[model samples]
Target: MPYVNIKVTREGVTETQKAALIKGVTDLLVEVLHKSPATTMVVIDEVDLDNWGIGGLPVTDYRRLAATSGQGSGSME
Candidate 1:
């Protein structure tokens, strides 16, 4: 069995978001890596806002950068 661990911030996480992430990852692993979703374990780890970073900056400043640019456009954000 193969295992995957994915970590993201916890502030805005939802069940649907988690499901999409898991499904997307599982799809890639199964289709590209020839892995079996039944046997593969994919885990998502959530972090506190204080712990994550964006564009060499902390998550605290991510929104400001996003406003300047666009959310999700920043490489590290």
Candidate 2:
């Protein structure tokens, strides 16, 4: 069996998207590794912004700073 873990910030992911991810991952493993879809496992983990960090700062704070600094879009959307 193949196990895949996917982690993303808990901001705006939907159930439909998560389902798609699981299906896609399983399909990929089946195609590439010849794994059985029935035995492949995919887990999605959503982490809070406060629990995730970037550039030595929390994701929430980093996003705020990035917005104020006129940097990148600073949003997943």
Candidate 3:
């Protein structure tokens, strides 16, 4: 079995999106590695913004700073 773990910040991801992610990951493994989709496993873990960090700062704070500075969109899309 192939195991995949996906971690993202807890924001506004819907159930449909999560299901799509799982299916996409599994399909990719099957196509690239010839893994069996029936046995492939994909796990999604959503962490709070405060618990996730970048540039030594929490994600929430970084996003706010980036937005004010116009340096980043602070969007996953």
Model 3's alpha-carbon lDDT is 0.89
Lowest summed-lDDT stretch of 10 residues in model 1? 68-77
For model 3, residues 1-77, the per-residue Cα lDDT tens digits are 89999999888889999999999999899899999999998889999888998978898888888889999765752
Q: Report, for every candidate in turn, its global Cα lDDT versus the true structure.
A: 0.82, 0.88, 0.89
Residue 19 accuracy (lDDT) in model 1? 94
- lDDT-superior candidate, 2 or 3: 3
In order, how many clashes per candidate?
0, 0, 0
For residue 14, what is the lDDT in candidate 3? 100
List where candidate 1 sits over 4 angstroms from the true fold. 54-56, 62-76
Cα deviation of 19 in candidate 1 (Å)? 1.1
In candidate 2, stretches whose alpha carbon ends up further than 4 angstroms from where it belongs are none
**Residue pairs of candidate 2 with colliding backbone atoms:** none
Q: Write the per-residue lDDT of candidate 2 for residues 14-39, one digit (tens) a residue.
A: 99999999999998998888999988
| Top candidate when judged by TM-score against the true structure | 3
What's the residue-level lDDT of 20 in candidate 2?
A: 96
TM-score of 3: 0.90
- lDDT, residue 44, candidate 1: 95
Residue 46 displacement (Å), model 3:
0.8
Predicted structure 1, TM vs. truth: 0.70
